[model samples]
Target: MERELPKQVFIDGCEQISMEFEPIGFRFAKSGPHASRRAGDWAFKISFQSNYLNVGGEYVELVVHASVYSKAIKEWDERSAWPASASDWVAGGQLGNLRTPHHWRTWNIVNPHTRQAEIANIVANIQTTVLPLFERFDVPRKLAEQVACSQVPGFMFPENAVRFVLWQLGPEAAENCLSYWVARLPSPDAFRSERDVPTLPDRLALGSDTNNLARVARAMKIGLSL
Candidate 1:
């Protein structure tokens, strides 16, 4: 009744990307098995919560694989071991012994049809999972508005099924959030919105869609009181 997992999946996207995409690729807080795959059916799921947000979603049936001709990295390796062997920095020829990288890992999100509805759903899931987390982290409302405005691209399916996406926010978005906001580093003002706020779902369909990243940035800037 179900297909088996593919031998492997390939990610397609910018080879060297920023950290803005971590929210979509790696799980932040919530933890569970990565998406499952089968032979006839191509399905995957990612569940992670930024200290600021939590997201969970699934693609029912799609053609999941690494990019055919793109330079992107899949979540796992040929052996399915994350944090690829080469991923580790070689400082002084030592492994796992070096300053942490600047940003989180990246992945290219792949879908079957690359349809607006599908992209909308993925973005919606991101918004559903992340907005509240950002709210929780006191990310400026304005910055959030900006991000929401340009979350998805207008095009066909990416070469890879679910490769990395850029996670690096513009300087404006990171200013009030992290000291070295390029990565997951904490923000001096990150906790400003620690107070009660809307649930992830409520925040997903919030505003008229134009005020998301901007409002989020603003909220983070002044430490909006949720």
Candidate 2:
């Protein structure tokens, strides 16, 4: 029979990792004191990643109660993989009253035979993989680029994230994302008015240059017509 792993295991593993690592702090958050099916929404958030994500290569900031996790040993069953995603791990978790953005991540580790081993695996992943990746790339802009190119379009860019988004999706799309409405217009100059395109702050705007996005555009054969 399958049994749900206690939430304490997650907390302990995260706590242990936080203690050993510098500049990372693990926090366990739940809505209320008691656990409920509805109130079961909780997460293990690492503060270091949240603060530094995107600056370097910080891709993720937290791990939450997975909608589903495997019940297996050390060996991962390749067949039991979750749907592939740019951000395949969970997101949309909250820290305190302030809502954190989509930065949650879950690893490919399968549930080990004993609860003790489960904790060890999680802790090791947090220390070795998650932390290193977070400090490096912050988060991959490709995930956001895919969303930008998809049918369901509505991801507002934070100021600092604009440059990275532009690098991935190209100038027109980046401007469209920053704009009130996303338009596949010819160029930044094509807009009739400021209202026609979104106004980007000086720091975020690409400023009449296609060079930054040139490589990405060339590879995808996008933005060549413009």
lDDT of 2 by residue, 1-226 (tens): 5543334333344554445543443333333211111112222234312222212121223242211111221112123221111222222122221212344454321243454554465566545544443332233455446444432211222222233344445566654434422243345344333222223221213433332233223332334443
lDDT of 1 by residue, 1-226 (tens): 3432222111111111112344444222212312211212122223321121212122222221110111122222233322123221100111111113312322222333443354354344434443333232233234333432322221011101011111223333334332222122143233333212333221212342222322333433322432
Q: What TM-score fits each model?
A: 0.18, 0.28
* Candidate 1 stretches greater than 4 Å from native: 1-111, 114-116, 139-226
The residue-level lDDT of candidate 2 at 123 comes to: 61
User: Compared to the true structure, candidate 1 yields what TM-score?
Assistant: 0.18
Residue 42, model 1: Cα distance from true site in angstroms: 34
lDDT of 1 at 99: 15
